[model samples]
Target: MRVEDGFQPVPFQEDNPYTSDPVLPSLLKRTLPSSAFQEINPDLERLGADVVTTIRPLGSSSRVYPPRLTQYDQWGRRVDDLETSEGWRDLKAYGQKEGLPGIFYERKYNEHSRSYGFAKMLLMVGDVHVVFCPLSMTDGTARVIELMGSAEMKEKILPRLISRDPDVAFTSGQWMTERPGGSDVSQTETVATPTGVNNAFGPQYTLNGFKWFSSATDSHVSVALARTGSPKAGSRGLSLFLVPLRLPLLRSPSDPVPPATSNNIFVHRLKNKIGTQIVPTAELSLEGSEAYLIGNLNEGVKSISPVLNITRVWSAVGSVGGLRRCLAIATAYAKVRSINGGTRLLQDSPLHVSQLAAINVLYRALTHLTFGAVRLLGKSECGVADADELRRLRMLTPIVKAFAAEKACAGMEEAMTALGGAGYMEENGFGRIIRDSLVEKIWEGTTTVLALDLARASQDPAVLNAFLSWVKNVVSSCPSDLHERLQKPLNVVNDAVSELASSLKKPIAPLVPRPALILAGYVTSSTYLLEHVIWSHTTGEDERETDVEVLRRWILEGGMVPATEDVRRATQDTDARVKADSTMIFGRSSRAKL
Candidate 1:
């Protein structure tokens, strides 16, 4: 007889991600009006099916074949060319042809268009090897150009940035991080020298400096921040520039191709990163890079602010997508994997299902929080937002970005744990999921940096008052019976809000920023869930029960407030805590003398 192998486990098969997710459709249904939902639902369905069948395979191939750089040609002349895999190229083509960026620009349904476009993103991002990273910058670049670019720049570049035709489309790299500073743009050292000359594209400059981190390095152009004034002028003295990464190849009339020229952008090296490896991130020296000024001089921060807002929203949505993917994998594995010596499937185990439920609950909460911001974005972009919506959008953008990312990191880890030993195996793909999710917490702004931004936003009386009033309005609108049902969790949320309000006046307020931001996220997300539940009841939709259940779970289980002792450590007893932290981290001898 032939040698027999040990018992083999059957491979796991994942259901179509769009159909398998119970929460997303219900969310779109609850958020969009009946007519709008009917109109966009079919597109969402198509993209959902394509995500698993087409986009995912391309994503896998991209990860398998990462990007590389060629610094010199065969004859030893400097070329500085970047090469990406066909799968990466195909994914980019698919995204462009599918109108990932065009959907928002088209605004076919007016303000609902962003929601429609982002819903497709929610379904597509998880399967696409973080290609959304470049797409995010591209969308941000388009938005900035639309709002701030010179008329000529807008007419020439904006359309291509958002074009649906892959051949005509362009992706943009955002180069903000520099060696001297990470998130602190005030410390940026890149300098731009005005050429004192106007090219066809408008005023030109020569930029010289090194960009520490340049994701989407393979992109055709970049929106960068460089000092045009005294270095001591800080961020206010900086100006935004559009830098071309490559020179157009001049083509002969017959050849229809031209000789390649340099834009003076030299890639020092591709980043060896933990995740998002499929995206070509690089360190580069901008040596006399040709640039076009965007907006007025000494207003770089203001010009780039819109781009940050857009990308931050992308980060939030992408974080949720990553968590969703991990959950999909874990959930699929649970059905096929056996336990109790093969007597029962893992899905049959209540404990296992509960583990999955915990992840699901967080995923649902983050989904609402992110999409709520997306809806506001659409309204703002369409010029239909009220003053209140504008302020809400400002505060919520940073909150959702930092909070969703931090929570999703933990949720993705839990999802991995749900898969047992198989999750640790690279072939199972949890490794890439977790690694990619980790970057969300750091990209744009880390949690600490964002917490400070939230603190600043709240300090503005108009912003804080608007948020508080909105919360009150949402709470007061609840129907009586449902209000009674939610009274306890609502009180929990209110209490946290009150604490935040009180802490803002305290001398230790700076110490409270992180906790304060956390409270804000909990409050807003809880409010969104509560609002959805009310809508579910009023609409009598099929998702009412699940909505209520998800709302209750999120309010109760999502850690609505910080612990009292933790608060004390952060605020009231900061001195003692610092000493303890120093001792713990630096050893007993390093503790400060009292």
Candidate 2:
């Protein structure tokens, strides 16, 4: 059965079920180069230190904020007061000055409970929930550019935004994804009719349409995508507007600012999601809402891509951090937990050793790839968008999100196995990790969606050719002495790609398990490329050569070949293989279905 078919809560046990293996930790430690630890060690320490400070004061028995408390006490109270102009004024005044909340706010809002990790980090403040709806009315960042573009708007808004006791907070909401339109901005039905000038800030537009799933729903300003051009104009016709949730006033020292107003933007409801629950995902209705245009009329999508690209990288990093945490927790637990009456869990078993070893490789490879992608993103020229950089982000985003999340879930499950029944309990945190990690794959995009994207990217001659060339370049750059060791896996990837290309022309049936195997091999190949690049750069050529040899022999002699065979069998066979020979012929099939 698929891991997600349903939660079958098994009873917690006191003994390890994976056998009396004691070499797991040592085996894992041996496989990872000391250097891999060097790069991440400091950061992990810093994070640990930070967590100590953050969570220590809360005490050991404190629980994540309850969802009902957040809803009834926080959101409800804020909304009821928000119904008043005075309440609106207070929120705007406070938000502008405080810069909103951090992780603390998320904990208050039950976002941790809801699963909005990063978003909660962005929004949550001390004990109270801070609202972000109005501030996100405009494309918060782009609005800065637009306001700067006009000296009048700048004079009016910039000072308060920059002021020590600012009265307004600027946040942005991404509202382009529609129910029926697959990320296609042009197919949006939201309309913005030209409304008469509000005062003298040029032409004002009245937005009247539905915007589903806006991030930063509590912000005061928002940049909303509306149909300003021809309805049939596709993406080019879609224009972005700075929608103000509250009326704006000139930045005057003497004048009394009026109470904040909600305009006509109404929230339909908040989304119940697998993760990122702290940041409210709201369906909004903009009914004759006041809005001003930012940038040229037909360039909204292009303008948004830059910001989205940066956010994507941040998301990738967040996933990596979570995954790393899972690994660390699992490994640490395996090292300390005793299995039987006399022996530690990781001290004596070959199977346990093998599992931990495999996990270590996955963790290290993912870390290098994620960090490398981060570096690549950092290297791209600012302002000018590079398609190559974007493509790389696109390609890596899904892989990191999907693979890291899946591995994290698996790692937690394995860690639980090490703990016997204790790990399965809520108090142990392994169950939480598994619960939380499940959302990572579903978020950004499902694995199925990502696989399709990969398939499509492979079909684009330019993208496909470029990717293949890049892979070849990576293969060529491997240390000469380690070529023999790396050759088998590299060839496996090449053959798979060739076969995939050929299958594109035919109506190939679902390979079921084969796809997972192929995907694993591809990821392994990619990991090798990433690890080589990072290790080579961090260490000298000579050191990298040695490390490469070690990694090569470890991977080849390890379970990779058997794993591939298992994938092939699971995909092609209708019946289960019970015999050892049958299993070996197919490789190691996953006990857990996709």
Give the best candidate by TM-score: 1
Q: What is the C-alpha lDDT profile of model 2 across 1-594, one tens digit per residue?
A: 898685444333222211121222222223334554344334334433433353223312232231221223444532312222333334334444433222112223231211122222222111112133333222234333433334545555444433325433344556776665645566888888887675344357888888876765654456667887887788888777666655553434465643333476766666676543344566777778888766677777765554444444344434444444444545565665555653545636677766666655555455445554444443342223366655654555445545555554665566567656665766665554455446556544556665565555445556545544566566666666555656776666555445444443223334432354235434444555445634454455544554554455445653445545544554444344434445566655733331
Please give the TM-score that candidate 1 achieves against the real structure. Answer: 0.95
lDDT of 2: 0.48
Best by lDDT: 1
Q: Each candidate: RMSD to true structure? A: 2.5, 11.6
Off by over 4 Å in 1: 1-6, 249-261, 506-508, 563-569, 587-594
lDDT of 1 by residue, 1-594 (tens): 444676568688888777788678888877788899997877777777788787878767434477888888999997766778888888888888888788999988889888888888788777778878888899999998898788876887888889888777889999999988899999888899999899766689999999999999988788999999998899989999998877652222255322123788888999999898888999999889889998889999999998899999989989998888889989999988987888999999999999998898898888888999999999999999999999989899999999999899899889988877888898887888788888998999999999888877877778888888888898899999888888878888777777766665535444677877777788888888888889888888887888888888887777874532244346676667677878988888877463
